[model samples]
Target chain A: AQRVTQPEKLLSVFKGAPVELKCNYSYSGSPELFWYVQYSRQRLQLLLRHISRESIKGFTADLNKGETSFHLKKPFAQEEDSAMYYCALKGGTSGSRLTFGEGTQLTVNP
Target chain B: EPEVTQTPSHQVTQMGQEVILRCVPISNHLYFYWYRQILGQKVEFLVSFYNNEISEKSEIFDDQFSVERPDGSNFTLKIRSTKLEDSAMYFCASSVGQGGGYGYTFGSGTRLTVV
Candidate 1:
């Protein structure tokens, strides 16, 4: 079975410090990975995807095929960056669905 | 700049009653999905609809759950005989296609409370 794992349920960081949220996945075939974020009282929104290879709100994630990981990172954490982040894998076959990780809560303290 | 919209941000229901959570996906999007998250839990996929049919569904989406695009603009999830366990935040999402770099757009979600 395909699964996504977000190792940390909660992570705290001081402002200006670097931040890393680890995500790992288990799947037999090639995978499409994504990072989605939900802020307090806000709807869930897409942050970034492996295929896009783009950065959003100063956060970037690199897809590591060999390691089967797509970890989200930021060079400097900001107080407003506090949010819940979920790692998701697009079920590969046709008419597929998205399998999501437990999610990690990132809190950047001022 | 289109976004998915869901009605009735919160709902209170009696167990065993039917409930419908409605959503209007992005106008041009072809793929629609329903997901739910129990308080403090990870979001779970319930069903995916495309071409006016259910393309995929999760194990949790039992016979009690059904989905339909009753009109050109509205997609709905109907739960028959709602259970207390069904209380959760239900979200609606849509995407351009099954495969794309662009991710799905999610609605604000409806919080269902069953007593």
Candidate 2:
């Protein structure tokens, strides 16, 4: 079975400080990882995907196969960056559904 | 941008009553899915739909649950008998390609509260 674990349930950082939300997964095959963000009163949206290797809103996550980790990181946290972040994994199969982590509620304090 | 839309932002119902959650997937998208998140719990997959039939469903999706794409764009999830444990935020998602790897557009979600 595919599973995702986000260690931190809540994290807080001062503005301009670095933030890292840890995520680990247990999957047999090569899995695609993604970071989804949900702002207050807003719908969940994709922040970044491992396959794309692109950063969104100053956030980036690297997929480490050896460690089975896909940690979301940002150089500097902003007040507006406060939101709920979820790590999701998708298997190689066509009809594979996403297995999501428990999610991290990040608060960036100004 | 194209997106998925869900109706009834919030619903409060009595236990054992039936409830139907509606969604309007992107017009060009072919795959539809339903997922829910209980309070403080991880998001879980309920079912997936393709070609007007269920393609995959999780153990949480029992006989009491059913899905249908009645027309061209509307997809609905019907829960036969609502339980107190069924209270959660239900999300409807759609993707253009085969799996979640292609990225999915999720609706704002419908918060169901069973009393």
Candidate 3:
């Protein structure tokens, strides 16, 4: 079974400080990872994907095969960045269903 | 910037009653999916649909649950008998294809409350 684990349920940081949301997965095959963000009263939106290797809103995540991790990181946290972040894995032989982590609440204090 | 849309932002139903959650995926997308998140739990996959058939479904999607693409664009999830545990935020998503690099676009989700 494919599983995703997000260790932190809540993370707090002051504005301009670096932020890292840890994520680990257990999957036999190569898996695609993604980070989804949900702001207050907004729909869940895709923040970044491992395959794209692109940064959005200054956020980036590197897929580490050896460690089986795809940690989302940002150089500096902004007050507006406060939101709930969910790490998801999409890879299984049968269908392209996503397995999501419990999610981490990030609060960037000004 | 196309997006997935779901109807009935909030639905309050009595236990054992039937409920239908509707969604309209991106116009050009080919794959569709349904997911649910309990108040404080992780998002879980319920079912996936493609080519007018069920591609996959999780254990939580039992006989009481069914999905249908009645029209060319509308996707609906029907629960025969709603249970208290069925109350959650149901999200609908879609993607171009399984192999595409694009991530699934999720709708705002329908909050179902069973009393």
- Highest lDDT: which candidate? 3
* Structure candidate 1, residue pairs in collision: none
Model 3 TM-score, 2 decimals: 0.98
| TM-score, ranked from best to worst | 3, 1, 2
lDDT of 1 by residue, A25-46 (tens): 9988888999999999889999
Better of 1 and 3 by DockQ: 1
| Residue B83's lDDT in candidate 1 | 97
Query: In model 2, which regions exceed 4 Å deviation?
Result: none
TM-score of each: 0.98, 0.97, 0.98
lDDT of 2 by residue, B1-115 (tens): 8879999999999999999999999999888999999988999999999888999999999999999998888999999999999999999999888644588899999999999
Error of 2 at B80 (Å): 0.6
Task: Give the alpha carbon lDDT tens digit for every residue of A1-110 in model 2.
Answer: 88999999999999999999999999898899999999997888989999989999999999999999999999999999999999999888625588999999999999
Q: lDDT per residue, candidate 1, B1-115, as tens digits?
A: 7889998899999999999999999999999999999998889999999999999899999999999999989999999999999999999999998886658999999999999
lDDT of 1 at A22: 98
Fnat per model, in the order given?
Answer: 0.83, 0.62, 0.77
Choose 1 or 2, whichever is better by TM-score: 1
Clashing pairs in 3: none
